[model samples]
Target: MEAEYLRHGVPLADYQLTKADHRRQREAVQVHEWVQRQLAEAPPWSDERWEEMRQLLGSPTPPWELQRWQLRLYCGHVIEATRNRNSPRPDGGVCDKKRCPDCGLDPAVIVAFEPLGPAAEPPAESHSLRSSRSTRQPPADRRSKAELVAENNALRAELEVLRDQA
Candidate 1:
């Protein structure tokens, strides 16, 4: 039987009675074709562009996108203040005294930092699990497994009857 099974390449599962095992198989030829397609479509990153990005980052190390977004916000405020002549600069260039030059506003004006801070820490795995647990409905409060099973059976019977009537 084993020799015949190997010789015919018959799946063993067909001979056995069991629950479904869902698994996907891909051809080697198809995998090779996908690799070729990916290589052809993807563009290589240039060293010059990388260097420019590093300079924009202000340090050799690059900060995360969130930090970059925060810095962008600050720079935008600084740009707006300077353009409007409201920047707090002693020479009226922008606030040199850490306050708005025109309006004497401190927090209202933006101050540019020479170096942007490092990126915030990535969220912990536990936090996500906890959040998901909190958001989900708890298991039904009904008493006894027998009662729940009875209820489920009743519902199924009702559904089957409705389908037959329809």
Candidate 2:
């Protein structure tokens, strides 16, 4: 994953530990600078602002499409004021300041770190049976919009019948 970060926008096939660390640190700094630039052009951040930034970055990969939870790791800032000194952030950095520059939030938070590429895919199909048994929902897209509405109405009627029976 560190290697992925190092090779993001450059032609480095392999880098020494110091070089890799430098690349990651450089990218992190760039992210911060980008945010500052956005804030300069537009004071506060928003979904639209992030979309603009994402478009400018031109990829959904790290240091770009990263969610707020993940952003806290990279930015050392958050929307809400927090002072947890032990909070683990990206690159093993921590910020206990009342006003952190890197903190922000989004509607969705990704709980795990994932590097770009095919390795991000799910585990092998050997556990397909277990996964299948747990998830019984039909694919949502299989039904048309009208079909879904009709099914919802039928389910409501069935629910009312069950209530009356009770």
lDDT, each prediction: 0.38, 0.41
Model 1, position 9, has a per-residue lDDT of 11
lDDT of 2: 0.41
Q: Assess candidate 2 and give its TM-score to the true structure.
A: 0.21
Candidate 1: give the clashing pairs.
Answer: 87-95, 87-101, 88-94, 88-95, 88-96, 88-101, 89-94, 89-95, 89-96
* Alpha-carbon shift of residue 109 in model 1 (angstroms): 1.7
Model 2 clashing residue pairs (backbone): 75-102, 77-102, 77-103, 78-103
lDDT of 2 by residue, 18-52 (tens): 45444655655566668788879976678998889
Q: Each prediction's TM-score against the native?
A: 0.18, 0.21
Error of 2 at 13 (Å): 26
Per residue, candidate 1 scores C-alpha lDDT tens digits across 10-54 of 222223221221111123234546877998998977999888988
| True lDDT of residue 11, candidate 1 | 28
